[model samples]
Target: MQILLISCTQTIAVLYRHVLEDSYCLFCSISKQRFTCLMSRKTAEVTL
Candidate 1:
Protein backbone atom coordinates (compact mmCIF):
# COMPACT_ATOMS: atom_id res chain seq x y z
CA MET A 1 0.00 0.00 0.00
CA GLN A 2 2.78 2.43 0.84
CA ILE A 3 4.61 1.63 -2.37
CA LEU A 4 1.52 2.25 -4.40
CA LEU A 5 0.94 5.54 -2.63
CA ILE A 6 4.52 6.61 -3.31
CA SER A 7 4.23 5.82 -6.99
CA CYS A 8 0.99 7.69 -7.26
CA THR A 9 2.46 10.69 -5.54
CA GLN A 10 5.42 10.68 -7.85
CA THR A 11 3.16 10.53 -10.87
CA ILE A 12 1.14 13.48 -9.62
CA ALA A 13 4.31 15.47 -9.03
CA VAL A 14 5.54 14.79 -12.54
CA LEU A 15 2.21 15.85 -14.01
CA TYR A 16 2.19 19.08 -12.02
CA ARG A 17 5.76 19.85 -13.06
CA HIS A 18 4.90 19.30 -16.69
CA VAL A 19 1.88 21.60 -16.42
CA LEU A 20 3.90 24.34 -14.74
CA GLU A 21 6.64 24.15 -17.33
CA ASP A 22 4.12 24.34 -20.15
CA SER A 23 2.45 27.39 -18.63
CA TYR A 24 5.79 29.07 -18.08
CA CYS A 25 6.80 28.45 -21.66
CA LEU A 26 3.51 29.88 -22.91
CA PHE A 27 3.95 32.98 -20.78
CA CYS A 28 7.50 33.48 -22.03
CA SER A 29 6.38 33.24 -25.64
CA ILE A 30 3.57 35.76 -25.11
CA SER A 31 5.85 38.21 -23.34
CA LYS A 32 8.48 37.84 -26.05
CA GLN A 33 5.96 38.68 -28.74
CA ARG A 34 4.76 41.72 -26.81
CA PHE A 35 8.32 42.85 -26.29
CA THR A 36 9.03 42.64 -30.00
CA CYS A 37 5.91 44.58 -30.83
CA LEU A 38 6.83 47.28 -28.36
CA MET A 39 10.35 47.51 -29.75
CA SER A 40 9.07 47.82 -33.30
CA ARG A 41 6.67 50.58 -32.31
CA LYS A 42 9.43 52.46 -30.59
CA THR A 43 11.66 52.19 -33.65
CA ALA A 44 8.86 53.45 -35.87
CA GLU A 45 8.31 56.44 -33.61
CA VAL A 46 12.01 57.25 -33.69
CA THR A 47 12.12 57.01 -37.46
CA LEU A 48 9.11 59.31 -37.79
Candidate 2:
Protein backbone atom coordinates (compact mmCIF):
# COMPACT_ATOMS: atom_id res chain seq x y z
CA MET A 1 0.00 0.00 0.00
CA GLN A 2 2.80 2.40 0.87
CA ILE A 3 4.54 1.60 -2.39
CA LEU A 4 1.43 2.39 -4.34
CA LEU A 5 1.09 5.73 -2.58
CA ILE A 6 4.71 6.62 -3.29
CA SER A 7 4.38 5.75 -6.94
CA CYS A 8 1.28 7.85 -7.28
CA THR A 9 2.98 10.80 -5.64
CA GLN A 10 5.97 10.52 -7.92
CA THR A 11 3.83 10.35 -11.01
CA ILE A 12 1.90 13.43 -9.99
CA ALA A 13 5.09 15.34 -9.22
CA VAL A 14 6.63 14.46 -12.56
CA LEU A 15 3.51 15.53 -14.43
CA TYR A 16 3.40 18.83 -12.57
CA ARG A 17 7.03 19.52 -13.36
CA HIS A 18 6.49 18.79 -17.03
CA VAL A 19 3.56 21.21 -17.13
CA LEU A 20 5.60 24.00 -15.52
CA GLU A 21 8.51 23.45 -17.87
CA ASP A 22 6.28 23.45 -20.93
CA SER A 23 4.60 26.71 -19.92
CA TYR A 24 7.94 28.38 -19.26
CA CYS A 25 9.28 27.25 -22.62
CA LEU A 26 6.20 28.54 -24.37
CA PHE A 27 6.56 31.94 -22.73
CA CYS A 28 10.24 32.14 -23.65
CA SER A 29 9.53 31.34 -27.30
CA ILE A 30 6.78 33.93 -27.51
CA SER A 31 8.97 36.62 -25.98
CA LYS A 32 11.80 35.72 -28.31
CA GLN A 33 9.54 36.05 -31.34
CA ARG A 34 8.30 39.42 -30.22
CA PHE A 35 11.83 40.62 -29.61
CA THR A 36 12.92 39.55 -33.06
CA CYS A 37 9.94 41.22 -34.66
CA LEU A 38 10.68 44.50 -32.89
CA MET A 39 14.33 44.36 -33.94
CA SER A 40 13.40 43.71 -37.57
CA ARG A 41 10.96 46.61 -37.57
CA LYS A 42 13.61 48.95 -36.21
CA THR A 43 16.04 47.86 -38.91
CA ALA A 44 13.45 48.33 -41.58
CA GLU A 45 12.73 51.87 -40.40
CA VAL A 46 16.43 52.67 -40.37
CA THR A 47 16.90 51.34 -43.89
CA LEU A 48 13.95 53.33 -45.18
Candidate 3:
Protein backbone atom coordinates (compact mmCIF):
# COMPACT_ATOMS: atom_id res chain seq x y z
CA MET A 1 0.00 0.00 0.00
CA GLN A 2 2.83 2.39 0.76
CA ILE A 3 4.46 1.65 -2.58
CA LEU A 4 1.21 2.32 -4.38
CA LEU A 5 0.88 5.64 -2.61
CA ILE A 6 4.39 6.64 -3.58
CA SER A 7 3.74 5.89 -7.23
CA CYS A 8 0.53 7.84 -7.15
CA THR A 9 2.25 10.85 -5.63
CA GLN A 10 4.96 10.77 -8.26
CA THR A 11 2.41 10.65 -11.04
CA ILE A 12 0.58 13.62 -9.63
CA ALA A 13 3.80 15.57 -9.34
CA VAL A 14 4.68 14.89 -12.95
CA LEU A 15 1.23 15.97 -14.11
CA TYR A 16 1.48 19.17 -12.14
CA ARG A 17 4.87 19.92 -13.60
CA HIS A 18 3.54 19.43 -17.12
CA VAL A 19 0.71 21.85 -16.47
CA LEU A 20 3.07 24.49 -15.13
CA GLU A 21 5.38 24.15 -18.10
CA ASP A 22 2.50 24.37 -20.58
CA SER A 23 1.23 27.56 -18.99
CA TYR A 24 4.68 29.11 -19.13
CA CYS A 25 4.99 28.22 -22.80
CA LEU A 26 1.64 29.80 -23.55
CA PHE A 27 2.44 32.93 -21.59
CA CYS A 28 5.76 33.40 -23.35
CA SER A 29 4.18 33.04 -26.78
CA ILE A 30 1.54 35.62 -25.93
CA SER A 31 4.11 38.02 -24.52
CA LYS A 32 6.34 37.66 -27.57
CA GLN A 33 3.44 38.39 -29.91
CA ARG A 34 2.49 41.46 -27.94
CA PHE A 35 6.05 42.70 -27.99
CA THR A 36 6.28 42.25 -31.73
CA CYS A 37 3.07 44.17 -32.28
CA LEU A 38 4.25 47.01 -30.13
CA MET A 39 7.53 47.21 -32.04
CA SER A 40 5.76 47.26 -35.40
CA ARG A 41 3.50 50.06 -34.25
CA LYS A 42 6.44 52.09 -33.11
CA THR A 43 8.16 51.68 -36.45
CA ALA A 44 5.05 52.78 -38.28
CA GLU A 45 4.76 55.86 -36.12
CA VAL A 46 8.35 56.82 -36.84
CA THR A 47 7.83 56.45 -40.58
CA LEU A 48 4.71 58.61 -40.49
> Mind giving the per-residue lDDT tens digits that candidate 2 earns over 1-48?
111111223333334443333221111111221211122122111110
lDDT of model 2, residue 38? 20
Error of 3 at 38 (Å): 39
Model 3, 1-48: lDDT tens per residue? 111111223333334443333221111111221211122122111110
Consecutive 10-residue window with the lowest summed lDDT within model 2: 39-48
Across 1-48, the per-residue lDDT of candidate 1 in tens digits comes to: 111111123333334443333221111111221211122122111110
Candidate 1: RMSD over Cα atoms?
19.7
Q: Once superposed on the true structure, which residue ranges of model 1 sit more than 4 Å away at CA?
A: 1-8, 18-48
Candidate 3, lDDT over the whole model: 0.23
- After superposing candidate 3 on the true structure, give the runs of residues whose Cα lies further than 4 Å from its correct spot: 1-8, 18-48
- Indicate the TM-score of model 3: 0.20
lDDT of each: 0.23, 0.23, 0.23
